[model samples]
Target: MKEERELQDVLVQLSSLAPGPADAPKPAGQALAVIKRQVKQEKRAGCQPWQRFWQNPNRRWATAVLSLLILFTVAFSFPAVRAAASDFLGLFRVQKFAAISVSSEQLALLERVAEEGVSPGELTIVNAPGALIPVNSLAAAARETGLEQVLSPAALGEPDEIDVVEGGDGRLIIDAAGARRIIELAGADPTLFPEKLDGKRVEVVIFSGVQQSWDDGTVLLQTTMPLVEYPGNLDPVPLGEAMLQMLGMNRNEAARLARTIDWTSTLLLPIPRNVATFNEITINGSSGLALASLDGQYGAVMWQQNDVLYLLTGSGDTVELQRIANSVR
Candidate 1:
C-alpha cells in the first residue's frame, strides 16, 4: 500500500511540470538572453526587471550600451573647449599676482625715502617713485598732433614784470616770471632760489624737448626734476651743456631754476652753425646751434658752434649762467 502511494505522488508532480498549452505561445530564444542579463544586472546592483522584459520582448540592453558610448565620445573630442577654459582661469590668476608683486616693491621704496629727511640739491620723487620712474620717462611723444618744440617765455604775447633778483654770489640776475613770480637766492650761497620748492604747476613758454627737429618732445627735456628739498646738496652735479642747458640747467646746484611749466611748441628753430667759447672748451652742450650764452660775470654773450655751447663755466654762477643764456635774443 505504501509503494502504491509513492507512485501516485510522483505522477502528480510530473503532470504539474509539463509545458503550458500550445495556444499560449512560449517565450522565444531571446528570452534566454533576458534571463542572463537580469542575473548580470542583479550582480551589478541594478534592478532586475525580468517581468518588464517579458511584457516587451523588443526591449534590448544594446540600446543602453550605445547611449553610454555616445556620451564618452562627446567628452573625449572637446579638447579645445577644455583647454580654453583652463587658459582663461590661469591668465586671470597670474595677472592678479603680478600686479600685487609690482606694487608692493614700489610702495616700500616710497616709504623708506619718506622716513629719511630730504636734503637740498638732491633730487627725489615725493609722490612719484624714482625706482618706478625711469629717467627717460619724463617725456613721452605728445599724442596730440602738431606739438613740435619748446617755446620760450618771450614767444608769448605779453611780458609780466617778473621778480628779477641779482644773485649775491654772481653778477647775473635770475629772471623769474609767471604766477606769483619771485626770484630769490636758492641756497645758502645766495646765488640760487628758495630753500624748498614745490613747483607743481608752472605754465611753460618754451619747448626744447629734443636735440634736433627730429628728436620728438619729452618732459624734463631741459627742465630737471628738482630735489625734494630745494638746494639740498651742496655738491651739485653738473648737467652737460646740451639742449638742456638752453633751458637753464645749472648742473647740480639749483636744478629747480631750470623750472619749466606746461608748455607746448608748434614751431621749430633751426640748429645754429656758430659757437661761443670760454677758456678753450665749448661752454654749453647745444654747441651754439639754437643755443647761446651770456658770460653774466663779464656781460658778454656766447654763440653756438658745432651744435655745442662755448665758454663752458664762466665766472657767473648757475643762476646767472642760466639767466644770461636765456636772455639771449
Candidate 2:
C-alpha cells in the first residue's frame, strides 16, 4: 500500500508539471485510480512483487532525472528581461544564486495563475530570441555563441549533442491595472504594488547560450552575461515582496525574503522543498547552488564565473554532481 501511494504521488508531481488549458478537466486523479486498479490486477495475476520494482535504486534515479530535466529545461528557456531607456537606473546581472524553499502546492498555484490569469497587458515581443540551433561540436557551439571559452565536464567526457541559442533584444510594457489583478487573484493585497511602477517599460536583452547533452541524460548550459535595465528612481523591493506573497508566502515572510534579495544582481532559484533538498556549495572555486532529490538519485549545480552562467543537471547524488561540476574548465 505504501509503495502504491508513493508511485501515485510521483505520478501526481509529473502531472502537475504539464500545464493544460485552464478549463481542461484534471485527469491526474482518474489516472491514479486506473493505476491502482492495474496494480491490483497484477497482484492477482501473480506478477513480480511491486515493492521490489519500486525499491530499485536505478529506477528511482531515472524518475528523478526525468523530472529535473523537464523542470530546468522549461526554466532556462525563459528570456532575460531588460529596459532600453538610457536613464534606466538598475542593471541586473546573474552574479550569484539563492535557492528558496517552495512547496509543491505553491508551485501548483503559480502554474494555475499562469494558465488562467490575465496578462501584464500592452506587452510586445521585439526580436525574440531565435530557437536553439543544433551544432556538430563544442567548438561550433562556442563559435556560434561567441564565448571565448566553452567549458565541458571532464568527468563525463564528450557530449553526444550540442545546441546554441542566438541572443536578441525585446521590450515589455507592464499595465499596472492588469498586474494588480494578478496579485488579487493570488490572494495578495493589490495595494502593495508601487504606484510609480505603473505603465513602466522594461527592455529585454537576450544573451547567446549553448547547451550540451550526454546520452545518459546529463545537460550543461552556458550563457554569456545577460542583463536587465530598470529606471533609476524605481524601487523594485515592493514588487518583489508582492510576488513572494503570490507564491504563497505570508506577508511578513515575503517581505523579509524580498529585502534580502539583491533584486538587481542575483538570480533566485525556487526549489520545491517536498521534492528536493538544496544548499550552497563551491564548484571549481566559484560559489554555486546545489539541489538534489530527497531520494538522492538526481541533482543539479548552478554557478557563475567570469560573467558566464553555467547550469548542470544529471542523475547522481550531490557529491557526484559536484565532482562533475568541478571537472568543467
Model 2, which residues run further than 4 Å from truth? Answer: 1-91, 127-130
Residue lDDT tens for model 2, 1-329: 99999999999989977856985765889989998998787777776432332344543443343333222222122311111111121246767777667788876766666555465545465665545678898888888889997899999999887878667665556666666766776667777766566777766566788878787767787887565655568776776677667657899998898898886666655567788888899988888888887876677777889998787877777788799999998
Candidate 1 lDDT over 1-329, as tens digits, reads: 99999999999989887777865545676778888887786677654343332233122221121111111111111122211111111111010000001123322432343233322111221221111111221123221112232222221222221111111110111121210111111111222322222332111111111111111111011111111111223222211111122222244422442233111110112111122122211223332211222322221223332221122122334344445445332
lDDT of 2 at 307: 90
Model 2 clash pairs are 82-203, 82-204, 83-203, 89-232
RMSD of each: 39.4, 14.2
The candidate scoring highest on lDDT is 2
Best by TM-score: 2
Superposed model 1: Cα runs more than 4 Å off: 1-118, 121-124, 127-208, 211-329
Candidate 2 lDDT for residue 207: 79
